[model samples]
Target: MKEVPASGAFRQLEPGPIVLVTTSYRGKPNIMTMGFHMMIQHAPPLIGCVIGPWDHSYSALRATGECVIAIPTIDLAETVVDIGNCSGDTVDKFERFGLTQQPAGSVAAPLIKECLANIECRVVDVVEHHSLFILEAERLWIDNDHREWRTLHHRGDGVFAADGNVLDLCDRMVKWRHFPR
Candidate 1:
């Protein structure tokens, strides 16, 4: 075994598809690219996402307490980077990136039309010091035709990896048959 630095471990160890977090305040909508996110629970679907206080979308997210986390496939890699490169403070990301905004079922934040999936969420809790927002997923929408879509994951800096290959471990793992459908 080899030793590695602990401080920057998350750079490469972080997992999950890069997502577009859309939040709306009043009648204005904003979208931001997010990579630091994870699912915290299964039942009722809880998610945890970190949005730094400095981010332009922070205020809107905090005030509204709702957002749409959209999962974009690798086909949107370039546009994802472009959205992340600019601040939503002075830019309308949807128009700037040529993205389509579709109304969400349970949230004011709009779903990104081109994404593979969109999860509508409402903030259930917040950890101010950490800028950690715990969300309850209220609704979900997915592109059935993109069932085989590959999603992009950020690998620190400007690098990213597209999901590839699949391993089935269901047989060796505990089944969720007891869980509600």
Candidate 2:
């Protein structure tokens, strides 16, 4: 086995798909690309994500305690990376990317019409030390008609993998039969 730096661990075990997080404070809305996030609970639908002060949207998220997590498909890969490359502090990402903003019902943050799914969330708790925000899903919106369903997975260092093929093993799961497929 080859020894690897601990700092490179994230590239080996990157969680879920790359997502776009939107926050609105005062009257201005902003969006940032997030690669560090995961589902923490199912009953209340809690999600844990890392949004530090370095991110321009962090202040808005902390002040308002609300944000929208938008899941973009493979087709929007370039736009997603471009959104992350620039700061919302200097650029109006929505306008710069020509992304359509749809009003969210539970949060002031706008949903990206181009994304595959959008989850409106409210911050339930914050771990200041780690800049971890625990969010509860308040609402969810999905584009049932969208043809592209593949999502992007960040592999660190600007590399990414797109979802491909299907592995249906639902029947093999004896313990998870009670849950929806």
Candidate 3:
């Protein structure tokens, strides 16, 4: 894979294809599709996400320091794209989309009940970089029941991939083009 310089101008390095992250402050709920997020460490298990300060939820996330990372399936591609394209400041996305916001453990931010897997998060660090706000959230609560499901993965150019047929990797490693078995 070609690596892009991190310091270069913001260009779609690669469509991150992560599930949507939701947050709420004082009963006001907000949701946004995020791709540049992942597990950064394992000792205590940490997650890092990036959000533009210009976004409405940025201030709420910074102020409340809490959020819920909702894992969406490929079926929700349209809604996920919609959430990303629009602004939560002017719209009540939850109500508009008829999404159910349910209670969570670690943070006051409600999790999307419709999503299969939900992880409650508490922001532990905030780093200001240019116009973006980097959030490091500790995974507080995880509601995972690994039912037969397909997760949404961004394929760039406005496309998503859900869990497809299982490729049995029970052998530990699949045949690789570069690495010899």
Each model's lDDT comes to 0.90, 0.92, 0.73
Identify the leading candidate in terms of TM-score.
2
How do the residues 1-181 of candidate 3 rate in per-residue lDDT, one tens digit apiece?
7877776523354344467778886778899888767566654556778888888878888889888888877667788888889888899999887888888866788878778778777777776773333344544444466443677767664676677787877476555443432
Regions of candidate 2 where Cα sits further than 4 Å from its true position: none
Candidate 1 lDDT over residue span 45-116, tens digit each: 999999999997789889999999999998898999888889888898989899999999989999998999
> Cα RMSD for candidate 2?
1.1
- CA lDDT, candidate 3, residue 37: 72
Error of 3 at 149 (Å): 1.0
Ranking by TM-score: 2, 1, 3
Clashes of 2: 0
All candidates: TM-score: 0.94, 0.96, 0.77
Q: Which ten residues in a row have the lowest lDDT in candidate 1?
A: 172-181
Model 3 spans with C-alpha error above 4 angstroms: 1-17, 130-148, 168-181
Model 1 spans > 4 angstroms off: 179-181
The TM-score obtained by model 2 is 0.96
Estimate, for each residue in 1-181, the C-alpha lDDT of model 2 and write its tens digit. 9998898887877847999999998989999999999889987899999997998899999899999999999999899999999998899999999999999997899999999999999999999999999999989999999899999999986689999898998778998776654
Q: How close is candidate 1 to the true structure, as a TM-score?
A: 0.94
